[model samples]
Target: MDKHRNLDCKDIEAITALLSKDGEALNYYKTNGAESVGHAFMIANLLHLHANVSEASLFYRHAFNLHGKSQTEYPLPQSLLQVSLLCLLKAGQPVPEEEIKELEKYAPSYANYIRGILIAWRGGDVKEAMSLIGNAFEGFHSGEEIDALYLEIALKYFPALTAPITDTSYSPIPRHLYMYWDKNPPKEIADNIKYHQELLGEDFTFFNQENAEEWLFEHFGSETLSLFQNTKHPAESADFLRLHVILNNGGWWLDADLRLKSLEQWEMLSRLPKNCRFFITEKFLIHNDFFGTVANDPILANALLTCYVNMLKHHGLYIPYKTGPGVFSRAVSRTVYSSFNHDAPLPSLAIGTAWEMFSIVEEFEVTYKSGGNWHTA
Candidate 1:
């Protein structure tokens, strides 16, 4: 397993298959020495990436327990503890009171962060939870591990603190689906596109590198087009492209590798309330990959402006913060928080649950594994 540390999606699929056979992986780890704690942590990450939240939580807990009993220090105890709690929360399982006490003992600030999430999860006061989370963020120094964790956790749980809207008068998102890829995509991505086209018929639009550039130039003119061209990676360019296309055309924007799980998921989309924008929140933050919106949505408008400013002002910033989920989540956080500050009605934004999002689409990510992953590039 150590040799397979750099596992790809195929490796993960294979391991998942092996683990599914009568809890073989779990039993093996139980019989093995505590030194396998690091391996358990790695396996937990793989499971989490593949959306096996329950199994990931179990493994994360196992790693946390094993690390406590071991002398090895590779998987920092604080990191393990944080991930364990987060995975448990994401899996919809109760974090044991003992674990909470443990977290409070070693990391009281993070304990407060978890408590804030628990309060929101348990339908407590929204303002109080927000205050606790905000204070937790202040306690962490910028660029620390906890800083990113705090941002992600706040983004995921903050919207839940807001009151639900009863109005439903906005226009429904267009049934159209838009996706993009390079001129020559891998067979897997191409097949995924074909599946969507078959499902959506004329409502599906596929954009390759050339056509996306053309569309950008046509809709946004040369300035935005140049910004698109200047992106350091295909994924970064995609971040710019999705915002512009959805802002102009108003439709579902799905990543090229995404495939709908079933027709039921399509029907679910149709049933979504006619909000100005619809987004799916994953484990930590609002994912940029799959979302829907009307043309010229203010949320997307803010996101686009943020991306542009990041590109021009903060050259060499990390991709996530520059043009990915980081900026998108911040846009959402701002919108929600600003509404509260002004005591105004919250925007008609619909956020799909992680369960709903996973039920709707699965990633057949072959290109990323074959060195085309922009994050790695």
Candidate 2:
């Protein structure tokens, strides 16, 4: 609190009065310092007088930026004064900046700091802006102080923003994201994991993407990130699935029309090296009732990739087929079928079919398919 000892008595009084209420007090402590239990006494007095909120937000922004940039190793009164600024802004008021003699002229170096303030003060998005600042800070600073300050502020406001995680209906957390449950492994899956103990025993400290992004952040050596949030098809190419898989994890992605097939298929599929990869039928077989009229879906079958159908059922059949524009995870939305190109150019060899593999072979020499074995031609 000593850093803000220069604050006028009237400003102090306004802040003290606001902190009297439990909610406002929590807000102050949240924005202030971690060791702020008894400090709320001064804050309550500030709120009782209730200074203009808009003006206070400016000071809060300055204070946070200052604190973040400061070399001082300890939390100070400057933090509490800034907490006043945050409270005022949270109350839907404007925050005014006292023109500083130190930065009277805007320099490019100082421009970044000003940008942070403006980003934080963005209307209707004060909390999001603040959190984004904190999240972005991890990208720029390796310092413990800034991270600690961000953690303190985030601890207060994120619970409300994160309430959706508990309600699975609206949860954005991906199925593949390392959830908290995956760390210890549930007792049932624990046994299954134990069966594969030799596989995972390579000694990776698996951090739940949900519970331990912080821990993962600490491991600067680790470049691994979960990219399951967006499933929208890329307009760039049919090969985006392959690139997407490579970027997120590694090696090749099998654009599988996956099913709970017989164990024999699983053994064969599993036997393939992760590098060699595998794809299920390039064409998916779905209920004909939903897609078309009769038991024989020659049109939709042709709509499926000829290579996929040939791989699954018959090698020699008069068929035209096309591949979906992008491969989508079934764990994601079932938009895979919808993403298939209805207007994809028909090959001279096949008409009125989603002929993906043959088209790739005709166009990009980079992609190929397998006959009974690997099809290079």
Relative to the true structure, how large is the alpha-carbon lDDT of every model?
Answer: 0.69, 0.29
Top candidate, metric lDDT: 1
lDDT of 1: 0.69
Cα lDDT tens digits for candidate 1, 1-377: 12221223235455455467435454554454224577778767766777667667666666766676432575666556766777777778777777767767766777777777777677777666665655454333222233344434444445543225454343477778899886788788888889888888898899988999899999889998899888898888888899999999888888887788876677667655655544545444667889888888888888888788878987677786778876676666667656655667767676656666777888765746565456623
RMSD of 2: 22.4
lDDT comparing candidate 2 with the true structure: 0.29
Poorest 10 consecutive residues by lDDT, candidate 2: 286-295
Q: Mind giving the per-residue lDDT tens digits that candidate 2 earns over 46-165?
A: 343365344344344334434433425323433434344445545654434542212223222232233334555463344543433433332221221233333333323333311221
Clash number for model 2?
Answer: 29
lDDT of 2 at 33: 36
